[model samples]
Target: MANKGPSFGLSRQIQDKINSKYDPELELILVEWITRQCSSDVGKPEPGKMEFQAWLKDGCVLSELINSLFPGEKPLKKTQSSSMAFKQMEKISQFLSAAEKYGVTKTDMFQTVDLWEAKDLAAVQRTLSALGSLAVTKDEGTYNGDPTWFFKKAQENKRDFTEDQMKAGKNVIGLQMGSNRGASQGGMSYGRQRQIL
Candidate 1:
């Protein structure tokens, strides 16, 4: 049977945007992080086969890639820190908190929120195409050094997401989902969006 699922791709348009917006070193770091995470979670042949460098930097791909490399493990719990590190550490802590609330991880792929409500696969596909799916790997919070920390953050903030908020969330997830799909689209296509069981 033909496998119908979302796939990832590297588009010239996106790559051009990233090249223009970010420094080459930053770009390489982001790409390497994403490629490594995708390669790791998807269990592909090798990291070199994962072409994340050519990806566009329009959405949260950079953040997601970073998260993938450095995950926050025990996300549900919070830690008390001194005021001395407040200026430097607050931002990082907040991001970890947010990611934990979302259960951030590379392998945690997204599905339609209404998947159970859809009567048929095609309907699900339509929803997925409109909203897009995401691979919730690493994000800003991953740098916290513990995947569980981010996971706990995800658990905490799971309810704060509204419908519109969820739609926006899909953009980043879609990119990761695309990576999992591989280069199936070839140069002609950047990614694929389809429903699956």
Candidate 2:
């Protein structure tokens, strides 16, 4: 017997967009993460072999990814109150608008949202993540230090510690250096030190 579920694969356009926007390393991570989230099997598909259906059972995988990438953005929650529903609708509107700006259509987003309505928190998250991913483009770079990035920026600003610099004994801020006393002065003192002959 054949598999009954919808075929898994990304449209050529979406695939192209993803490839262009994300670096190869980041793409691999995304693929791996998605696979881990969606698949029941322990082994994951190769990066090149990843398909939309592989990790997108509903949209939860995408939602989790979005949450991780954009810590400031909150996913829509399932609500019973009418007022909360209104607020959720407003957030959805904003997301759809943003997605439109990035080439995704309101219809496309609505379909995903509708399919996952009244489902668990994971479903809501996945729907939002799908929308968020659609809205991202190459022009808008990712947030700094987001773990989504596979290749991180080079540490060019790192300063090497010299013998004199180490000997200077610069006090670190917010770090407790001595005994664990309740109110002991642990901060670095900026004043000059006196030496006894």
Candidate 3:
């Protein structure tokens, strides 16, 4: 990627394959969700990979999106836009860390270069999807977009049993626990004869 010159042959193929993973439908969903969350300030991007990448490359909008989900004080301090590569990457890193603290797990997080360099835009989409799912699941009233927009994650279900019920359940054996009622070893023999002690 350092060489901005035109790619060729295998490299071009690889790049195209990577870019192909970008989902246009996912782009529209993410764009609409972001615009709703960030209010009218964050303009909508044209429905395309490059357009989506351009809209969020600087990371300022992402910081705003995540901040808007918070109740009181925002996680990020400064989300000012910058024209430099390192600065942009720094902002992206900050947003990523803030998102992590905001409840997105490390496994669900995307890398800075994934957005900055357009290396894996699908990864960006995945991270946003995870954030949306989390926000919807939390349902703390801070999330701005429509609840249906993001699929709500399932919550843990705990069940408690009374002492009598637990004892009765333990006393009975399930069918899955195989029985030794039949004499299965009657005619079974292999590998040399067994010796009597």
Candidate 4:
């Protein structure tokens, strides 16, 4: 995109559509969540698209947010701010890695370019939403924000069955499987006429 210059015609419209997907309400929720988790030192972003982008562009706030979520030892060593493009990107990457280590699955994590380039802020919001949900679900007491900010993700409930139970269940068929009883191919099938070889 750097070499492609400005967006034009259909491309510009597509870009606008993508940008429109950014939700201000979710942004406020995320901003408040961050403010609560990391403290007032990180500062708040003005509620707008570019401001949100610029706030997280450096990734220092993000690194601090992830570190704050940790119980004791921080996954990120330092939350350094840098003006250099590569350094800024590196900080975002480190934040992402630390996030993954803190139980954010790869699917829930956003890429460095997503926040830095502002290509897909909605994706960034989704990542943050997932993070909030995870933190709420874990309930480890490290989470600092309001508990209602994000809904808790469903936890895994594993059930074990003994061999006797399994064997007894094998004879029973659930309604979901649908019964074949009292039914037969009494006539031609529905889809197509029977074809002769």
Which ranges in model 4 have alpha carbons more than 4 Å from their true place? 1-5, 177-197
lDDT of 4: 0.89
Write model 3 residue lDDT over 123-150, tens digit each, in one string: 8998999999999998889788778877
Q: CA lDDT, every prediction?
A: 0.33, 0.42, 0.88, 0.89
| Cand. 3 Cα-lDDT | 0.88
Clashes of 2: 3
All candidates: TM-score: 0.19, 0.26, 0.85, 0.85
Q: Compose the digit string of candidate 2's lDDT tens values, residues 1-197.
A: 13345324575555455335333454455555544443443244444423333433333444343433333554434312233434444444544454455444444454333322421223333344444344243324433222443333233478799988786766444465565668866686669686779
Candidate 4 local lDDT, residue 105: 88
Give lDDT: candidate 4, residue 127.
89
Alpha-carbon runs more than 4 Å astray in model 1: 1-19, 41-197
> What's the lDDT for residue 67 in model 4?
90
Residues 49-163, candidate 4, lDDT per residue (tens digit)? 8899899999899999999888999888878788898989999998888888878889878888889898889889988898898899999998988888898988999999999
- Per residue, candidate 1 scores C-alpha lDDT tens digits across 1-197 of 13435424656555444334323343243334344553443222222212322121111332333344344453323333233434223433343344434544422322221122111223222221211112223244333222331122222334577899888877665554555544554556346666578
| Higher-ranked by lDDT: 1 or 3 | 3
Residue 42 accuracy (lDDT) in model 1: 29
lDDT score for residue 123 of model 1: 27
User: Of the candidates numbered 2 and 4, which has the greater TM-score value?
Assistant: 4
Clashes of each: 37, 3, 0, 0
